[model samples]
Structures are given as C-alpha cells and as structure tokens.
Target: MIRVRVVTSRRLHVASLSTCTTPDSLLAYGSRILHCPDPHKKVALTFECQNRWKSEALPVYTGSLWGSDEAPGLPARGPRPELLAPKKMPSMKQLQTQASIPVIMLHALAHIELGAIDNYWDTLVRFDPVKFQLPRDFYDDFLTVAGDEARHFQMVDNRLRELGSEYGALPATRALLEHAANTAADLAARIAIVPLVQEARGLDSGDRLVHRMKSMGDKESAKVVEQIVWEERNHVRCGMKWFQHLAKVQKREQDQVAYFQELVLQFFPDGLPGPFDVEARQEANMGTEWYESLESKVAHPSGVKLEKRGDTQSASVAAFAASKKKVILAGSVWPERTSSAAGVRSADIIQVLQERGYQVLCVSPSRLNDHTSKLQEEQGVRCIQADANTDIFQKLLLETMPQLVVFDRFIAEEMYGWQAKKYSPEALRVLDLQDVHFIRRAREFAVKKQGLNFKETLDGEQLDIDPVEKIAIRELASIHRSDLTLYVSDFERDLLVSRFQVPDMNLHRCDFFYPAIDVSKLNSFNDRRHIAFIGSFKHSPNVDAVEWAKKHIMPVYRNLGGDAEVHIYGSYGETKRFVKLNDPKQGFFMKGFAPDAHETLSQYRLSIAPLRFGAGIKGKIADSWFVGTPCVSTSIGAEGMSLDGLQWGGTIADTPDTFASEMLHLYNDEARWDVAHQAGVAACSARYDASRNGDSLMERLERTMVEKRELREKNWMGRILWSENYRATEYMSRYIHAKNDGVNNGVK
Candidate 1:
C-alpha cells in the first residue's frame, strides 16, 4: 500500500510510488499528479511521472482510459502563493518602467510556469484519448513542454532569490489556467487556446521583456528570459503543427486563416493586444498578414465608438471641429520626440493642415507613447486609435464623413482607401507616396550589386523580381486611384508620370518642409568640430552608410591628419547590431539615438550622407542645412533636391576616395567650410523654407478637395482599381466583420 506523510510548505513527504503506484497508462499517471495535495508536490510528481513514462516504467495509453468520460475532474492542490483577481496583476509596461515591479513580474511569470506544467499534465489526462487519435509525437511534444516549463520555473525562481525576493513574496492570478480550462475536454480547442493563442502571446511580449531587462542593467536575468523566449518558439511551433494536423483531419485545410481566426475569436473575444513581436511569430509560422487580418476581424466587429480625449488642445479642437469641415489624416505613423525623417514630415504636414482650418484628426493604430501623447496634447491634433485594417476604421470614416482623407503611403491606401471611398465617397482620397518605393527598391538592388558599376545595372534596366514588381504595381495602382498623389521630390514626380505612366493630372509636387531656422540660435561654423551622421539605423541604407564610412572613409580621413571623428547618431532597434563596428582607434564612434536630431547636428561642423541608394530628399543632408552645417553626400543622397550645382551648400560625391577628399578639404580649409556652410543656408532657404513649402502643400490639399470629382474622372485607372478590385476586399472585410459580430453575440 502507498503511504502519504504529512507535508509542510517547505518540504515534500511522499512514499516511493514506483512499487505501489503502478500507473498503467498516461491518464493514470496524470490523475496521480493532478490530484497531488500540494502545489510543489504536484510539480514534483509531474516530473517524476514524466521521467518514469519516458523510461517506460509507466506505460503509454495505446487504446483508451477504461472510463475516460467518467474520469474525475482536475483536483485541488495545496496552495500558499495566494491567487488574486486579474485586476491585481501588474502590466508589462509598468513592470518595465519601475524597478520594484520586475520582481513582482518575475514572481508572476514563475506562477505562470507552474500553472503551465500543470496545464500540460491536465490536458493529457482529462481529454478522451481515442477521440483525438493523437500520434505518439503529440505526447512527446507535451511532455517536452512540461519539462521546459519546469526548468523555466527554476530559472525565474533562482532570479527572484538573486533579487532578495522569493516566489511567494507576491500574489499572482489564475488567469492562465482559467483560460486553459475553456477547452479542458476538447483537444483542438486546447491546442488553439493554449499554445497558438496563449504561448504565442508570450512570444509577442518576449523581446520587450528582454529589452527592458537589459535597459535595467540586469543582463544575467535578461539572458535567462531571452533563452526562454527562444525555446518557447518550439512550443508554439508544436501547437501550430498539431493544430494544422487536426484541421486537415477535419477538412478545414482550405480556410486555415479563417478557422484559426474563428477559434481565437471564440476564446478571446476582444482580440489580442499589440504591438506584437512580428519577428518571433513569423519564426513560429504565424505570419503577420494571417494574424493581423484576424486582429482586425475580432477587435472591431460591428463598429467602434470614437472617444475624443478631453484634454487641453484635443478638447479645443473637438469643440472647433464640431462646427468646421473635418479632414481625417489616417496613417499608422505617429510623431515622436526622437522621430524618423518620415515622422517629422508627417508632423509638419498635419500641423499645416490644422492651421489651414481643416480640423485634422490624425488616426493612428494605437496610442504610441508619452512622446506622441505629449505631441498631440501640444499640437491640438487629436489622434484616434482606429487601425485602418479594422471594421472600426470603416465606421470611423462613416461617422466622421470627412471632406478629405490622406493615406500616408501606398500600403496605408491599400489597407483603408477603399473603405474611405465606400463610406465617405465624397471625401477626396490623397495618396502621399513620400517618394516612390519601387524606385527606391530598384535603386537599392542596383546599389547592393555594387562590384559592378550601378550605372550599368540601374540605367534602363529592371530587377525582374517580385518585390520590385509588386511595389511597382501596387504603388502605381495607388497613384491611379487617388485624386492627388503627393511627391516630395520633383525627380520622383516626373519618374511616376514618365516611367510608370501615372497621369500627370493626378500628381502633385510638394517638397519636404524643413522647419524655419532661428538665425539667432544658430551654432557658428567656428564653434563646431567633428563630422556627424544622423539617420535612424533602423533604415537599411543608413546602416550601410555607417558600415561603409567606418571601413572606407574613416581610416583615410584620420590618416590624412584630420583629428575630428565621424560620430554616428540614430535611433537603434538593436544596438548590438552596430556595436561590433565601434572602434575608437579608427576615429569612428557609434552614438546611439539622439534626443534631438537637430540639436545634435548643430554641434557638428559637418555631416556625411554616403547613401548609395534611396529615394526622395535625404533628411541628413536637408536637416544638416537647417542646423547650420554642410554635408558631403553621394548623388543618391543629394538626389531630388536641385542642389546639384549649389555653391553654398553640400557637395555630392560617388566614390569613397572623392568623398574622403571632400571631407578633408572642408575640414582643413576654413574658407571652403564657410562657403559650403553658407551654401547649405542658401539651399535651406531655397528648397525647404517651411513658409513656402508648407503653404504650397496646404494650397494643393485645398485644391484637390475642391476639384476631387474632375480629378477622379480624368484618371480612368482610378475608377477601375476603386471599383473592380476594391469589390473583393470590401466584401471580404464585411464577411469577417459579420463573423466577428456573431462571435461576440454568441459568447456566454
């Protein structure tokens, strides 16, 4: 007979089960573990049973449990770490921001692991064995998941001890197990809800947790968390594989996305909260398009009610807009304190739109961050979190019924332009290409194939790949479909009309608007020293430029007795990607992310933008001029701005030797520096003076709205894309919306 001794919180007391507790099948072993009285003892029993099962000491279920349906439900276990309601839990954001909160978060994650171990065990035991007809690998996958979870618990528990905390020092919620309980009897539902949905959420939040831990200077803890994140991908992949296998068995192969989405909606009615980790999810075989499409379906089923924040500036705008004509600027981009070049452009244009009495509502996907919130507070531009991919966006368009809707780029237009046309048909759709993406891709392809002269590959040649072809087709279609397409460069404007044969009648030229320089606050050329490179390293061209400069230009500049270093500045996604390139011996420094890009440029004597390939005006070159510095860039870098022959501004150089020579000349000779500096000032005034460019773009915006019908009529392709192709997308969106609504109404 088996003997069970009295157990305490700190000690496990159980007789050796190998002799008396002869579990003949997987379910009996699970029953023994699940019914264990203490939580710690339960986990111990789980591991022991799993080991025994692996060694064949306990047998695998070949047929079925004798009385599976009559098998007892999940039993209660002794618990000292108290369970609180979901409201008591701390959010990941709060945990990231505060020092003390991470300890609590670690405690919470530890609890999650314990529960996950129990969950996997409970799944194998509670579900009827023969119904699933699960292959042997299914049991292996779950056992491996259980083992990993046990190890994860140890890792986090060890981390807590390192932090002078214990696992039970804080309370955690039972939400994980509660979610798992929804499909306790069904195998497919368990796989969908647990691994695909729940574990997938872990992958989404993993990078952020690692980034936070690193930022908090807990590298050891970060390493452990990162390893867990990497390992968890297999767990998610297992879920997907089993889910697909089950789907195939059920003849649901043709509608995998729809079926998976339906299950997610059934389990999680309100949709998954994001910004999701697209990279990790893609590795698990759940691509962004699949889930992102589902997100739209579930998040906003029928429609969404717009909530205008009752704040200082947004409130004032709300009162004003109640009476005036509204213009909705729907885009995913939001203004940041440390913004990209495109972000800065959008901010300036929106400001101008508001000033022109259009009462602009900047619709972004989500409330970005404090920086963006503060910007909206100050600018009087209301930012609504209505994602363009959702039915809520269509409702937003219908409710507002603006006279004009501006798409940030071709992708944005493709996502929501049809909805804008359907709901607010009178609203003039303006597609802001922001420079042709296809041309940029083509140029980048030519540049990447650099051993051979790019001129040969680029001039009158084609890429013949899907990327270039897709961008060309999509962008050209967006251009043809819009009443007006805004181009930042004259070169791109002419290229679209001439090369792509986009109707010139629909194209509008609006040069990038640079903020007016305060002459009084300008850093004098004499006061500055080193050369600076300012561009977000998130962009491929910027990273390439920095790497090129470090290898080719920096050594030459230093060898020639130029003491000044080339400092690289940008918002870095992963600083490690560039950290290896940093060598002080070469007079090359990686200054990660500037708080104010303009202020950083102001301190530099000069700037370099050796961008071999990109489209539109280079912000580094344009912004350098605004901050009273000159730039030496490649022809691609200085393209689009008619600054080819400027005497006072930047010099364009193609090769590294020419570029290095120009840098040395400008640095050593003060007169030549002054000439280039003054030329930059002249170029800033000539091309990017905000008063001129901003006013012109504003006027164009007004004119397009005034003549929307005539402009739409002139472009026949616009009618074809908006009508024929749009019908499919429009109907599909409606079907998803209806299905999501049904899910919402059906929930208990």
Candidate 2:
C-alpha cells in the first residue's frame, strides 16, 4: 500500500509514516494543522508542510504495512471563520450590487479552497490503502492536488488581506465539506461528484467570474482566479483520470457517460444543476458529450427524448397534418363536475381550442373499462383512453398528430410527455401545473408539523422543505422537461423562478382562466344566511382548514353575536374522522357532499376558508364569487385569486377573531357586501371571462407552436434532457410494462 510520509526539518529526511497506522501521531505536524481551527494558521502550516515535502535531500523510508492502525477521520469544524447556514450567504446578484462584492466573493472562494485542502488530505489519510489497496500513484496524485489547493487558498487569502479583509472576517457555508462528508465511504463517488461534478462546475464558471472581476477593475484578483481556473482544470483532469482508472479496475466500460450519470443520480437528488463550462471540461478530458449527458440528467426535469427522423414520409405527413392545427391534451384523469375548478377550466379550454379551428383530443391514461365514454358524452369533448404503458398510446399520438400537446399536470407530463416527443417530435409540449404539487405538499407539511396557527404561511417566511427532497426532484424534472409550464398563481410562478431557480421564460401564468363565471346569472346578495366552507375533504389542507374554523373561528363568531350556523360542506365530512367535528347546536354542521355546489353555496351570504398552507389559487374563493357569496379567508386562501379584501368579494384574515369579525361584518352590512359582490362580478367579467382568457391561452399556444424550434433552442436544458436523459425513463417504463404483461399472461 502506498503511503504519504512526513519529511522532518532536523535530518532533511523523509520518515516512515503510515497515515492510518499511527493512532496518535499521523505525521504530528500535518495532523496538528488538520485539527487547527484558525483558517489563517491552518493554511500557513499546510504551506510549510508542502515546502518540506518538496525538499530534494528528503530520504525515503520503506516499512511493513501495519494491520492494526486506525485511519484519521475528518477534522472538527473550526471556531474561527464562522460557519453559517446556506441561507445566510447573500445571493450572487445581491453581492454584485454591493460595493465590495469582489472581495467578499474572493474570501468565500479562499474558504472553499481551504476546505478543499483539508478534504484531499483527509481522504489521503482516512482511506487506508491496506484495506482497499489503491495504487501508489493514487496517493501521489491526491497529495499533489492537496498541495495545489493550499497554494490556491494562499492566493485568495492574500488577495483578501490586500482588500483590507481576512478569510475569517466573513461567514462561509459548509457546502464544500458537506459534499466531502456525503461521499466519505465511497471512493468512486468522491471522485465523480467532487472533481467531475463539483470541480467541473468551477471550470464552467471560472471564465465568467474572471471576466466579471476584470470588469470590476480588480485585475490582480482576476489574474489570481484566472490562474486558479487553469490549474483547477488539472484537478478535474486528475479526478476524471482516477475515476476512469477505478472504473477499469472494477471491470466497468471505458469512457461510459451512462456510468457517470448513474453515479450523479446515486449521489444527487436533482441531477447536475447547470449552465456548464464546456471548454474547460474538454480541457480536463471530460468530453462535451459526457458533460451534456450529466447536464441532461440534472437540468432536465423530464428525461430528454431523441427525435427519430428516420422516416421522411412520416415527417412530411406530420408537417402537412400540423397545418390543420391539431392539439392533444393529456391528463391523469378526466375532470368531473361543472362546479369543479379543474373541470370548468378543462371545458373552457376545449371550447376555445375548437372555436379557434384546432382539432383537440383529450386523452387520459384510464383503463378501457373506466368512465371515459361517459365523460366524453357529458363534457361534449371527444375523450380517449390511451394507456401510457402500451404502444397504443404511441399509436394514438401518431394518428392524432398533434401540433401542440398539453400535459394536464406534472404527473401527466412524466407519464406521457416522452411519447409526445417520440411520436410527435414537432409538437409543442406544455405542462399545465395544476398548482405545483411539491409546493402544496411542502405547505401541508408545515401545517401538520407546526399546527394551523403557524405564522410562517401568512408572514411570507420562505417555506423550506415541508416537501421531502424526493418530491422536489420529481416536480423540478417535470418543469424542466416541458417546453413551458402554466401556473395558475403568480405567487407560485414567482416561487418557482426565485426559490426553485426555474428559468422565468419556461413559466406561463394565467390565473384568470380557471374562474370563469357568467356575471349576469349570479344571484344578488339578498336574503342569504349562515357562514359556509366547501372543499373536497380528501385534500389535507381542506380538512385542516375546517378543523381550524371549528376551533378558532366558531367560538369568536358565537361570542360576537353572530347567530348564523356555520355549514361545512365536502364529500368526506361524514367520514369516520370528521363526524366528530359536527355539532348542530353549536351552529357548526357538516353538510356532506352537495350534488350541486353552486346551488347549495348560492344560499349562503358569505364563505370562509381559513387555509393555513397550500399552493395555487383557491377554488373556494372563486366559487363564492361565482355564486355572489362574499368570502373571508386567510392570506393563504386568497393566494392566486388576485384579490385585495373587498376588491374581489373576499376579506383575508389570518387571526381567528379577525376571521370571525370579517365574516360577521360581510354577512350583516348590506352596503359592504354589495361592494364586494359587485367587485367579484367585475373580476369575473374582466379577468375570468372564459372567452377572453381562452383566446389569450389559444394565442399563446399558437405562438408557441409557430416558434417551436426557436423555443427549443432557447430552452437548451430541456432540449438536452429530452434528447439524452429521456431514453433511460423510456426503456425503464417499457421494461415495467413488459414485466406487468408477463405477470398478467401467466395469471390467465
């Protein structure tokens, strides 16, 4: 087993030192620097050690490999140079706007390099060759990387001092160390993620960062980083070389892009998030094809689909067919009920598409025995059952030959989006995010854990990770893969762009499309009584809201001389868990599942939705407006409605007492109620007129279809995913289908 030895100043000689062989003294000086908490002293000692290592007079010592020695693990976090959470760091844009953004940036980079030195050194010592028997040159290469990292640290640290700041002056995140910690047990993963993935990112960003510094008139700093950038290419080269070496030793295929992608997927939840630096990666011998594949996995929300351009006749036929303006709308299920928001939107969309002379086919992945025919008859739109797992689905696409394909939700896009790309390559794929599922799940998690009264939902505190990492990965993939995603709420649209880092051009917000109502037909606010809340209680937030209303709003209502009963109407109100919340004497009655939502709701003077956490527009508020029923709700409930208190027939109240007061006031005051009701009617007419919104959506779709290639070029990430990453998902889906069919056949 190859080992790194410590060269002593006394003899100018290299002494035998096994990194893991000594329990207490693993090169006394090197180990001490590793344990040092101060960043400045740590770097200084590391340099001193490197200087001794380079001495020509240093003699080599060969000794028997010890079996009983323990490996030295990662050092403890240092006290100096405070480690802050990722949120504490200012955004790159924010830093650029500051007077000393360059200095702060340099300091942060120095801290990262310092961490890198430790990481390399730790890996060298901790991963015992006796146990794993890695080649001698492996240690030699890493030792060189460690030494180079120390020099890189010194360059930036010195630059920081010249700028009147030191390495410990600013707070840094533990991002560099966290990655190291994640791959501690696996050597190949360490090589793939750290050098190939993480370091490769640096290669991509280096030129831009250097140019930015030069633009800022920091020539010296720019030169320093430029040098580091060039040198870092070698580090990436080392990582790539070693990774290939290890892969070959393990009998893996040479230069395999799929193997690299597999490692990334195994390590990262979201495959390589990127705006890659292609040139530097090529210099490091990571071919453009390899980087593209990695980028496709990480950046693509849906797997990329390669266009099969083999049949020129089919292409000609597709082009000719496209002139007819055919569209195929795919959904997870057929939306049921005219009163349903999704159903209403779906119906209006079909009407508008047809009016525009586009042939539209609404398809669902329901089994043949499902109610597809009944739904088609009721909706007056041709609905088809296209089983996504079968070749029949592909046939359906080829036959309809849609110019535009609408993915009803992210899930639909995941299931059938690749098929659209396969059978209809020219089609413009759009994902209508029926409210981002992950965001909804995240808010639901916060509500469950922190209780209904948690102020984070109302105060606009960044709701971080109520949804687990897995859900986020899936949703992001769906968004990235689709050409464009339709958002119902501007707030959610902004969240996707700002927090989730989705490119803005990929999102389309059309809140007004979901709440179309005939203002002339709405009942006047007269002779109405009782407070009402309505939702499908199968939704967790709806259940939470109802429970909150009973506990928080009901007592306040009764105390304020509000004698009206509070009716909770939903499908699951009479279910086992909810039956207990019903108490007619206390003026809270659970009216389970109204056959006609508008008919039951129109009798009420006011509506209430104390939604704590959820995403997209609230359907209840829209329903209230359509029925001429004013609403009092929490800010969360009012989201995506574009409502401002009385401006849209709703009052937003977060507190329990305030919610009860708003409900009572709207129920009693005819003048205020009239204002809210009229505003709601105006909103419905202006913003949610089906014809108007439908026309706008149709226009956008037509424009997108026309500029499909241009749009694809602009969304290169999606293009890459569709072309490269999508094959894995396609084959996997096919494999699953085959397996299921075989099982079914055996059973028969």
lDDT of all the models against the reference? 0.71, 0.69
* lDDT by residue for model 1 (1-748), tens: 6655444453233332343566666665666665665656656666776787788646555232333331235445456566667898667665455437668768878887777777787776566545666777777878878777877888888888899886776656756557556776567788888888778889877766776777678877776777677678878888888888878877887886678888888877667666555546655756544566555333333355434344664554445457467877766455553567787787777777777776777766544445456666788666666554456677666666788888887766766778888888998889887777777776666668534443443343343335367457767887888888888887777667766778887877766677667777888768998999988765668878888888888777777777888888876523334777878887788887688888899999989998866788777788888888989988777777755566647677777788898898887788888888888888888888878887888788788778887877777787887776555455655655565556555532
Which number leads on lDDT?
1
Model 2 lDDT, residue 13, Cα: 28
Model 2 misplacement above 4 A: 1-323, 368-371, 458-461, 512-522, 643-646, 723-728, 738-748
The reply for model 1, stretches above 4 Å from the true place, is: 1-99, 106-289, 296-321, 389-391, 445-465, 515-521, 726-728
What are the RMSDs of all candidates, in order? 10.6, 22.7
Query: Across residues 1-748, which tens digit of lDDT does each residue of candidate 2 receive?
Result: 3354544432222333433333222244345556566666666666565555565322112233432112245555677677777988767676555428888789788887887887776666555454455775776677678778887888898888898887877677866667667877877777888888878888877766776798789988887887687777888989977887777766675645667777888977444644455435644767544544333211222344423223643453355356577777887666555435666566667667777887666766543222445445554455566556556568767766777888887667766888888888988899988787777776776778656555675433367664445567767888988887888888887778887778887777665453456667767666687888899765668888999888888899899999988998876454435878988889899887787777888899888889888888877777777778888988888877764443756677889989889888888888999888877666656666666777778777777778778878887667667776555556655654564444334422
Candidate 2: C-alpha lDDT: 0.69
**Alpha-carbon shift of residue 723 in model 2 (angstroms):** 4.7
